[model samples]
Target chain A: MRTEGATVAFLDIEKVVFTYPGRAPVVDGVDWRMQAGEFHCLLGRSGCGKTTLLKLAAGLLKPQSGRIVLRGGELAAPGPQVGFMFQAPTLLDWLSALDNVLLPVSLQRRPTPQDAQRALRLLDQLGLASHAQHHPRQLSGGQQSRVALARALVLEPPLLLLDEPFAALDAITRAELQDDLLRTCRERGTTVLFVTHDINEAVYLGDRIALMHGGRIVENWTITLPAPRMQAMRHGPAFNDYCARVRAAMDGAGT
Target chain B: MNPTPMQARLLAAALFLVLLGLWELVVRQWGLSALVLPAPSAVAQALWSGLASGYFWPHVRATLQALFLGLAAGSIVGLLAGMALAESELLERVLKPYVVVSQVVPKLALAPLFVLWFGFGMLPTVLITALICFFPLMENTLTGLRQTDAQRLQLFRMLGATRLQTLLRLKLPMGLPPSLRGCAWPWCWRWSASSWPSSWVRAKAWAPWSSPPRA
Candidate 1:
């Protein structure tokens, strides 16, 4: 949370490049940055490397070239300062919901009563108070995703990297989760790098959308939509216009 | 219609009695020797005499001792070796061949070599039993650890979990059920091994005892 200067970016990715073994570069030399409390979405088609870029930002993967710095410090590996959400809920089935939420704290040492209390509070905040004692199989997919969201927020991490966390949910559930995510993240002022292929989702959730093509940022847009983004805004002309532009840009990039 | 629990129990008991009666009648009619096929009554008489004369106690003690001791030793060692093998790939690569060879050579063949080293007594037999129980548990533990969900592992990595923490909190707990199954499957093998050692020990001594089988 400490800042070296007023001009220092919260999260900075500088000319990072990565490739899997025996494959072409998935994330070809890319440079990007996010300011404190900014919501940025990386939008791309399948296999275009948006997820790989997010992983690089989270320090889950090392770049073949260049560097990534968080809070003006070089990112070497995954640390508690950043929270990550995978495409699937990825909850441990053997543990109860509350125990799973407290896993991050419990990993280093025994969870103090305060940690348990905090985890319970997070579950309650996510409307999962009653289901705190349930195992993953006992909960619905949407509920599981909510728990995963709470886990990502439990450390009160300054930066969050999410890889299409709601892609599997029904439309209504997805909308509700998006609202919950926006409200919680805005209140905490967490800088988020969300990866998704959905242009509408990017337009709806992000303050800025970065269109990625072939492992590079092809276009970037600053959403000027009114604050407290409402469900009604999705039908507005301004929202439709932004979605249309992003779609066209994606099409052009694909070609 | 399906029978109730009590009826099912009674039916099983009645069926057992009928089978026993048929066996007794066939043996008596054929004038078969007890050495070949003992009748139910002959078996009961021997059991009663063994208990009344107190001839069965030491044999029973020896057998029980071997059974419990072998299972305890084998299961514990197997579980630990499994944990070790699962934790380090280098350790697995360095030692896996020997582990496989130990299992590959039949225990029956190894019994004599154990006798040569430990002498004709309970120790060699227990060693063989322990060796018999080792492979399944180790294999199961390795499999369970390896089979952990990739996404969950990624989640752990993202949460800043150390290697030890991941093993204790995630891998070990996940591997336990399979490890227990390893214990269960070898139970029948344990019983056979219990009786097997005494005969195997006698055969090694070249002095076959004429005593009836101890139950």
Candidate 2:
């Protein structure tokens, strides 16, 4: 909600509303703004429009009533400046891990040799270089999701939209991914909008957390927990305080 | 039934012999003429004689040529039409009703009209073969394309892949092979097996009755 000065918003959703045919609005007139390099988590219950909001921000869905603007232009349709990672890895089964990472590059242009090298480097960063030639099915669940993240990062888009990307993973793998993402995005200075149902996950990873209920954001909090996002942060008093606040905000908020 | 490969083969052979024996008995007991319903032995003898004389080779070659050509041509039309329907909602809306209606009409009824328009040659028969084959290919291909992974499709769109790029990079790889199998393996087999006989290819042999088809 605060942009400080004359900085053009990296991403903006102004009174956006979306609904399925013959149904009530799934995403009501909700407005959100994210500055560059901010890692924001959208936390909510299962049917609380979190994924819909992420999709709207990613330019995969059109807001039925209002609009979403990205990088100073109306994001009427999906464009190259945004990256999306869904709940599943969605790696092409026919392509190798490295090839999966390079898919966006290959789709937009004839990827140069340098582009391929960059893809390999991304795989290396994700610790999947050894499995570059392996198909998606050969990789474990956490590994596949990491590959998905690598694919999303291939373009180094200014904004990344993730929809509960790690909820399916075991706890240890989830923590490692959270840490890796924390270091990687902050270093790259990428703005991120991550969706999740897990409260601790939000507290663990978000620089700011927005809690959505029914069709709108009911609460927003800037978490000042110490970073590097290690395991100790999960048990810290500040972390628990933020969690309790989020829980209290959820009580009888949406029907 | 419960056994090694060799035992399975022996069981198949035993069933074949018993089936032939029953056929032979039923024809003999009914006192049916050979022309109406030939016994298995009579049919085998005719096949042996036909082979010895090399009488059916040209017809066999003609049929195979029509079949493969029909398959290749039909596949192209079917896949392209299916891709169009999948990529554009407008095309799907415009074309799907006609496709469903075409399927409802018996394809054999169109063969005579084709013959009337093109004359009684290989073209008419080839056209009929293609017509018979394309429907299954189109239907199966449409199904495959419609069934592509929603997650992958969203990824393709969000990455700003062009429609052509999405078709080539995502849709074809995911849909083409399954659609090929759907039409080529089972659906086409059942439909073509039942349909091809009523088509023009069979007309030449049956001019009162051609020799039973070789395989």
User: What TM-score, computed on C-alpha atoms, does each candidate reach?
Assistant: 0.86, 0.79
Off by over 4 Å in 1: A1-6, B1-25, B178-215
Best by lDDT: 1
- What docking grade does candidate 2 earn? acceptable
Candidate number of the best TM-score: 1
Question: Candidate 1's residue-wise lDDT over A15-96, tens digit each?
Answer: 9999999999999989898999999999999989999999899999999999998988999899889999999999877677
TM-score of candidate 1 chain A against the true chain A: 0.96
Residue-wise C-alpha lDDT for candidate 2, range B134-203, written one tens digit per residue? 8888877788778888888888888887666666666666775733432333322223223345445545
Candidate 2 lDDT score at position A109: 60
Alpha carbon lDDT at A40, candidate 1: 95
Candidate 1 whole-model C-alpha lDDT, 0 to 1 = 0.87
Worst 10 residues of 1 chain A by lDDT: A103-112
Task: Write one digit per residue (lDDT tens) for candidate 1, span B172-197.
Answer: 66566743533442332222322456
